[model samples]
Target chain A: MAPALREFCYWMDRYRRVWRGTVVISVANPLLFLAAMGAGLGKLVDANHSGHLTGTPYLDFLAPGLLAAAAMQTGVIEATFPVFQSARSGGNYPAAAATPMRPVDILGGHLLFVAFRVLLSGLLFLAVVVAFGVVGPARALLAAGPVLLTGMAFAAPLMGWAVGVDRQSRLNGLYRFVVMPLYMFSGTFFPISQLPHWLRSVATCTPLYQGVALTRGAGLGGSHPGATAVHVGYLLALTAAGVWAARRSYTRRLNR
Target chain B: MGDESAGAGVLIEAVGLRKVHTPRGGGEATEAVAGIDFRVHRGEAFGFLGPNGAGKSTTMRMVAAVSPVSGGTLRVLGMDPKTHGPAIRARLGSVPQDDTLDTELTVRENLLVYGRYFGLPRAEIRERATQLLDFARLVDKADEQVEALSGGMRRRLTIARSLVNRPDILLLDEPTTGLDPQARHLLWERLFRLKQEGVTLLLTTHYMDEAEQLCDRLVVMDHGRIVAQGTPRGLIAGHCTREVLELRFDDQEAAAGKIRHLGDRQEKLPDRLLVYADDGEDALKAVHRTGVEPLTALVRRSGLEDVFLTLTGRTLVD
Candidate 1:
């Protein structure tokens, strides 16, 4: 086995005993949000502003939006505290670095595990969305690709930043000032076109907006190929950049 | 020595090895390892004995192939550390000062997962985990979380985890620094057994007795420099007398002036006076004849403590 894969087994072994507690975030939280917002609150919006929703039901539009948003939340949440813990003194990064594993191998293994987590959660969310009749099975399955990519785009760079953090309080600020704003305003719950002009452009620049657009287009079936290419390209480039940053941060923090 | 084993040669060789750490923001770069030279033979226990912040851990980090060297050259297992760090590390096991065991995993899982880092086969790692649990005396706590273990147990597990690959050389930095006496002795015994089994051991410690108990050879370090290097007995013999006579007087300064001519050399500590002489009993008698009535007196064999005091003119722990 390669060293990175070997380091990956360490996290997998740890997750085996603690994965039960995470079902709430991965399965339950999204399910509850879908039921309350998509079915309950969505009822009022569909009954009145059906024309504004482009003739699609609010439940249909909100399901894929929630899927993309949930991926962002899970990806950032998973990448932040765990990365900080591993990079801290008396943590596993130093221990792993003591063996044949290099700092790059350590970062690679951790990101690989994060990708697995995002993919697993995305699949679960898609299955539930399909059951609700929000989108067809084929469309829901296609949406999974964009959902996973969206998660990685957020998770990868945050992993790098978390390694250099001096304390846990910085992570809380990131959630409040960065992640929460992106979640609330990135065209997840409503269309960005409703926003004032300048704010719409700002929302479009955020990674979560691209994610929301991709999943919504894949689920509803009317996206232009050129626009779809743009969304995918943007997410791919961000994820690659995040990986590069994480490699540099891990070497500086762990190897020292 | 057997021919095959003898041909293996020195396990580690360093010439003027150095490490300089530049502060993160903007500060002067301090040299942690100031151009030191040392060698470790294949099957002996070698040690670095020094006080805290004496560059012992820094030197150990460089030899373990984790910290980059600032100057000079270092070779481990006949490979240059700068170019072949991963390769050198593959054959070595490191037990750091802190216990970095995975707290979420069980004691047995810690060993098993660490073994996987070396890409060992699953069956082999399983077998190794069982034996290592037994070796660490953690068989009963194998299924328990690491957080539930005591400091000593956690330390033993750390040591056992480092051995999963059956490494050729084992590096321990301050292994018993925070343990209780019984725990320290237990760890020492385990380390002694490993040394007897011919797993070359390199360790750093502040306790003079630990060095005397385990090290076949040692170097006394202070301020990033080696002051003396030799076997415990040889170091004591070279730097101190055969015995030390300690006297506690109400006024040490006054008593020191009175009994100045009694011994070969005298060191006055805050509470007592240490007289170095071949015969401590005779030295004590000489002090009494000089009309200085000490409240208490002791005669004992000289050891590494005196050697360090004689070489550096200071105590080791302070």
Candidate 2:
């Protein structure tokens, strides 16, 4: 356990050093998206609804969804290529395998680091959401828990996929064909009601969709408790499945 | 030369160990280790001498606990790798065929991070890293990123990294495979010092001179089987004649045909002819008496390469 903790800390420190560019880019993208879509598109929504959106400002309706989307993106990106690189190209996991730490410890240590990055990046995005005057400070703090959980829900499965994948080409295709499409359709920038019925069904089933709905409900205060519970259930199921798959992949690859 | 009795206990023992790797595309499974048995005593350097694709790395990997045995039984430090891998691996240091150093980290940071993997304390890791940097002669480049270092420097740093845990058994796979003569000699000297300090070393190499210089005993493998195993001198004396005579001619076939009649044993290579005899000088004289004037003649003592060629019916390299 002590060795696992030390390995986790070492990776965290290494990531912190190597990920400065990523952190900057992550912080900048959310701020830019807010300026463009929140400010630009908020004008159109407000003008159409007489300076109100369902009796709230246009920015308020969009801010929480953006926060959730940013967290999911941060988590998936943090947990995907870098994880694959450590396991394969960088041979970092092989180096760790030579130590007293087992494969499970290695995976757990990496997940710990990914979880921390998700939370920290989510907090940074939350600060941006607050700067846009989207929610009160208390609600924003409350929103962080679900947003961070949403990040983990997305990260867990992506990490599983990363381990089983031997090539980056397939992951690149997934990001383009699956992740981007899901992000666009998942009600981050708009309401799911705007999507077609068949597409809406697919969007509602995705973990990101549930994450965005849960975060919006907690941050913007219109989502009901029962609806939020359903979303949480889906995320929990996905997290469990992802963890099991990741454990199996790590054990198979390492032991072989 | 040192106190041999102090390090006489068995350090590694294997009973009919075997490993089979199924190809990714699924054909017949290749038996990489086919029920080989051997024991390595404490404080002695042992080697696996084979050419490429000869199962040397596979055998080393099993002993390192990174590769599982498909059949038979094996033990390192008297611990089964399947059950006690972590404990067994903790006391073992491995230098793999390729350098796996973290390219993004500085040399010092690499050592520190690797030591941390072994649960070493920060102060102790720092001290050990410092000493290793001095041992590898990379103290001047301690702060430089590993990617910027040369190959020899990186190889040395890797050796240093393996010592971070101060392991009991050190496994080096082709430790000087591509190194220059000077670098290879330097590494051999460092390894000799480690042997002197009573660290049990296991090495795999294709370089016969390397085996003769470092290994006290070695196993020659071919086609996933141990063809011969003994001390270098013993194997040479047992399998090959004491001396060899080389006779070169413009036409290797004519020289080989003529030389065959001059000695009890002979081998014909494309470029030259080799006559194996207890006395190379007397064999040369006998070949001269055959009245076949060769372009050049040379005589030298036999070594491991002769043994490998005599047993395998081929040289270690094509």
Cα deviation at A219, candidate 2, in Å, is: 1.8
TM-score chain B for all models.
0.96, 0.95
| Candidate 1: residue pairs that collide | none
Please tell me which predicted candidate would have the highest lDDT against the true structure. Answer: 1
Q: Predicted candidate 2: what Cα RMSD to the true structure?
A: 3.4
lDDT of 2 by residue, B197-296 (tens): 9999999999999999999999999888899999999999999999999888987776667666676688877777888999999998988888888899
Model 1: docking quality category: medium
**lDDT for position A164 in model 2:** 62
**Candidate 1 TM-score versus the reference:** 0.94
* Candidate 1 local lDDT, B1-318, one digit each (tens): 222332456888889988899988999999888999998998889999988888999999989988888998888888877778888888899999988899999898898889888888999999999999999999999999998999999989999998999989999999999999999999999999999899999999999899999999999998899999999999999999999999998888888888888888988777789999999999988888888899999999998989888988888887
CAPRI quality band, candidate 2:
medium
- For model 2, the stretches where C-alpha displacement exceeds 4 angstroms are A49-58, B1-8, B23-27, B247-250, B270-272, B281-298
The candidate maximizing TM-score is 1
